[model samples]
Target: MSVTVREVATPEPGRGEVRVRVHGSSVNKGDRLVMMGTPYVMRLALGLRAPKHFGLGQDVAGVVSAVGDGVTRWQVGEAVFGELTLGAAWAEEVVAQADQLARAPKNVPLAEAGSLPVAALTAWQAVVEEGRVEAGDRIVVNGGSGSVGSYVVQLAKARGAHVTAVVRAHHADRAQALGADAIVDAELEDFSATDARYDVCIDVAGSVPMSRGLRAVKQKGTYVVVGGPTDDPWLRPLLRPLGWMLRGAFSSRRVAVFVARPTPERFAELAAWVEAGRITPLFDSRCTLDELPQALAELESGRRRGKVLVEVHHRV
Candidate 1:
């Protein structure tokens, strides 16, 4: 549960890999789960006693400083952004497969692009891939003001779906600005208990019960679970989603437990969306590399409205 900034050897790119001089990275839910080593079942892949990998970040944006053998997709100075599933993005340099990165969006600062990879990809997958959202579809996004939820609201809206954003009282305006057609303040309203139904129910907050989320979806509609309680020391986060998936078999509605799988093509699509002004990355705060622990603490406190960016090589 403790994090420290320490010096490590500069990593070198191997075959078909590229080393990026990282300018920015951001704290993500995965980072927190790994750092805490919770939901004990994850330990099997991480480590039984402690995590095998200590690096704590997934999203990265920077210039490709070096490319290894057989890598021709990038040059020595091309600006790129991507995700590293196992977490190594907190450092000044990171080595990743050439296929893992995509050209950074020209409309945004390269550092700011770091905030887009994981969260944006998750939203894209939820709204487009999983939910199959389309024009005239009524979609409700739980946690509309969150990092992923913010993008979901916009993406769904851009797809011509009517977006209902379920958010905290303080995040109402932000959700509205994100193109949410309706704002259901969680403090004053329980969207699950409402008579209104949606063609797609995207639960990014995981604050509501799974059955209720499923109930909110119309018959034959889709219920996509993007996140859940991560603080549990045992199986809460994992088990909760599994339970939803199991319950789906008996119900008329479709249920999906979403796990983001990022691809270079998807990254390109997100970049295009940003450049076209269809979606924008939201930021709650910024912090230096050395201050990442504090930034992550703020993220875990559930007080942040959007992405918490960490400036690695700030000069970018």
Candidate 2:
């Protein structure tokens, strides 16, 4: 009943699909929530009993083993990576929609490349697409030490924005080292009441007050959310990055919700960032498939400093 790899028929690529021999898969916080089958709501899609999708991982990096009809953007043996909807990534082979996968940078390791899919896209969408943030803009990234938060700091800096990161005192050094112009130890400082308001805000941690977060941004400034879970799953929805986004738009301050979709363009840009050395991998370690349960527990504890990758190459 576990999401362990088993002997199954090798799935052939359908039109617009590619059969990928999975090398590595990066774990997500959402993956942990679904795995726990929390609040009985996640089970509806994951499975009423066991997970419908047997493979556990959602973000993947691997080589294209076979390309199906109408697939022209890639070829066999090419390294590619992307995020998946119903994760089948904890396997030796997976069928991926061509549009969701992008060519990995030649210089980046496959294991680290898998880390880009969800987190990087979330940062890019918040800063690039929805936030419409520009250089010299003053920005605040709440939970700036988390997976997506780290990327937001780097991306905001690349855009020439003056970035402030709200993280724990323990994580202030790491966030600052990642290029945050200013660091706020939320554990020790009052972020909302600070006179230093921002032109834009990206909430990836969901730890700050909803209304207070909106107020933290200057008039005509924008706020976007990217994370989705907390201790209480139900409240997590309202407190999530998306829910905060909805509440922001209705208020006088501009608010936008971004569910970072798996797109080729975004994936390509992230890969380029990695290639150019503009974005470095924040991957900390790899957890085997058997360690999934413990890993999920650790993630829920809210202490993981970086991406926890799941190695899927053992099936070979």
Q: lDDT scores for all predictions?
A: 0.89, 0.79
User: Candidate 1 versus the native: TM-score?
Assistant: 0.95
What are the per-residue Cα lDDT tens digits for candidate 1 across 181-289?
9999998989999899999999999988765777799999999999898777887888898898898888999998878999999999999999999998777789888
> Candidate 2 — worst ten consecutive residues by lDDT sum?
230-239
Q: How big is the positional error of residue 82 in model 1, measured in Å on the Cα after superposition?
A: 0.9
Best by TM-score: 1
User: Candidate 2, residue 101: CA error in Å?
Assistant: 1.0
Q: How many clashes show up per model? A: 0, 0
lDDT (Cα, tens digit) per residue for candidate 2, span 198-312: 8888878866677577778888888776765555755456446556656865887888876778788888888898888788767667776667556656666756546787766
Off by over 4 Å in 1: 298-306, 314-316
Q: After superposition, how far is residue 132 of candidate 2 from its true place, in Å?
A: 1.7
